[model samples]
Target: MMWPSQNARRMWATVATFAAFLGGFLAYLNVEPVAVLFQGQHLQNLFRDVFPPRLAVLWERSGLWWSVVETLAMAFAGTTLGLAFALPAGLAGAANTTPHGGLRAAVRFQLSLERALSSFFILMVLLIAFGLGPFAATVTLALGTLGGFGKLFAESLERVEAAPAEALAALGASRSQQICFAVLPQAAPALITGSLYAFDINLRAAIALGIFGAGGLGAELLLAYNTLRYHDVLALALVSLVLVTAVERVSDFLRQRI
Candidate 1:
């Protein structure tokens, strides 16, 4: 093993270079240790403030449960709308699906644009146009989902086996026919997986979207935080944690089945 010539030297050199790069980046960012984290009093004060989440407040606040329902609906609708647009856009962007290079490039560029715009910014603009509501949040989530899902779907389409497509071609099958018979079938599992994953992402995004006037648990949490209702904030956070965990389990099960 030691007779590997200069390989060991090269490996050591790479390690040294990586270490230097990391050191330089850390220095540039000026990362500092949290002195407060080491202080017992600070830790105690923080916990004392956040203790005992107010679950009863949820029932006290009329329509709070409905707000949760609205948030879930926003996520579902956004994912559905995003999938609707992503399927066609992804197909057009896929190298194997669309023969024309120019069209593929165009579709890819559009997807890139969609992905580049953050849901936060999109909600800000939509809030001006649509006013404050779940509508803005839904649309914001849809745009983000469109870009992310479209790229993933296109990659899945490109990754499908070429032999089936080739066989279809040999049989004088049309492009659309080949896609329907070969590519779609092969990519269906991936499509479902990606869509489910995107739904999870959209659900998280919907929460953040509430900060910019999109109504949801995020809006309620923000209000509680501003009004010094830490217990309500804690309760909301716990609910979100449970919901996310449930979605994770469901997604994992579905992925395994696929």
Candidate 2:
């Protein structure tokens, strides 16, 4: 029963406070926004170097298409491997399906630790053990997918309607039976949706990992940048944009159907 005027005043106060804080932070960082925006010489040099992407690089560059195929393969392999482990981990982590509270806590904590470690950092560590290649990049993507999808799948399983599970329990179904017949059936749609989302995320991560010498389109991009082939870099960036956009579109379509 607060007055609308009071709500408006509160909103305005919050906005003013945020603006003041942001302004203070920028000042502390010595950020001269207007000066940066008006850096005409630097901006002009950048534009001149990068304009007119080399469209022919899409086909002209030897092994460019092979790299694209390698990227797709990495994403697919990583997602499949991660989700294979994630399903069981999710079953163990979920509140309703977990065998015990201790097991659930352990599983969830492991997942959190995995998520806390960035994929790039993990990839760096893995490169030492596995050596730099698509294999290392693929493993990094798999671990990332496992961490993210496990948590999401656990939450999805936990959110499944309880009535069906309870009914199965009352009919003297075992814990495993209840989970398999009741909980999983209801949670299937959410799990499928999460899997698709995980694939989308891992595809982007694979590209980024390749930049660190993981060997794919990202490696190509890094090489172009290091060689000062700005035109080629721009063309590679366009290819990445198209690949991500296509996957996103397909993922959206699948999610809608689910």
Candidate 3:
């Protein structure tokens, strides 16, 4: 009737969790394992068609180079615009930094609303108002980034050491003055890091926005896919991969410096 030791309970819990996962995985796997070997024929055919990616498509296709440039521009502008809004919203949303409870609540609610809508959905709505193009994609990415960045920046603000701000307050500094002198200096690093991260995410979202007529590499890629141009798809995919990787490396380097 004695209770099990902590180690024994932990071990039993791990075993039970593993058993449940295995059972669910087996139940969900409707296809026979042997069928996987035969499935390679279709995979091989796909690889054969997709191999030797048509790098020439980047040049041979009219406006493709411009389209890539447009996509990068959209991502950059969107992140910049989103950060502009998020900076103020984040300041207002932070419990310590906000001027009042009502303002904080209102800002938090607005951020929640913005974060709730995905960029793809936002693009759909903007398309009706602005028509199809990179403009819609830029706006979509901006809104999505705003919501997420606002919340992140607010949290960063709230986590900054209160002592400096309190000391500033005791020295007769106004809230805005205190924030400028004390809070902002501490939070600036996080704000920059978050903005860069959002830019990376927006770049990918801008591509997806192309599927819905936002006119970036995504739209071009979708066209290639719809036409069953496997080589083109593979080529476009490689470009996207290289672009994302390069951005990620640069962002990582900057973040480390922060």
Best by lDDT: 2
The Cα RMSD in angstroms, rounded to one decimal, for candidate 3 relative to the true structure is: 3.4
Poorest lDDT segment (10 consecutive residues) of candidate 1: 31-40
Question: Residue 60 of model 2: what lDDT?
Answer: 88
Clash count for candidate 2 is 0
Clashing pairs in 1: none
lDDT of 3 by residue, 1-258 (tens): 645697789899999999888867866986445566585586788789999799899889998878888888989999998889999999999999898999999999999999897767778889889986677788888888889999999999999999999999999999899999999999988888888899899888777777677887877898999999989999999988988889889999989987
TM-score per prediction, in order, is 0.86, 0.92, 0.86
Flag regions of model 1 displaced more than 4 Å: 1-31, 255-258
In terms of TM-score, which candidate is stronger, 1 or 2? 2
Give the whole-model CA lDDT for all candidates, comma-separated: 0.86, 0.92, 0.87
What is the lDDT, from 0 to 100, of the residue 150 in candidate 2? Answer: 92
Ranking by lDDT: 2, 3, 1
Residues 153-186, candidate 2: write the lDDT tens digits.
Answer: 9999999999998999999999999999999999
Q: Which should have the higher lDDT, number 2 or number 3? A: 2
Give the 10-residue window scoring lowest on summed lDDT in candidate 3. 31-40
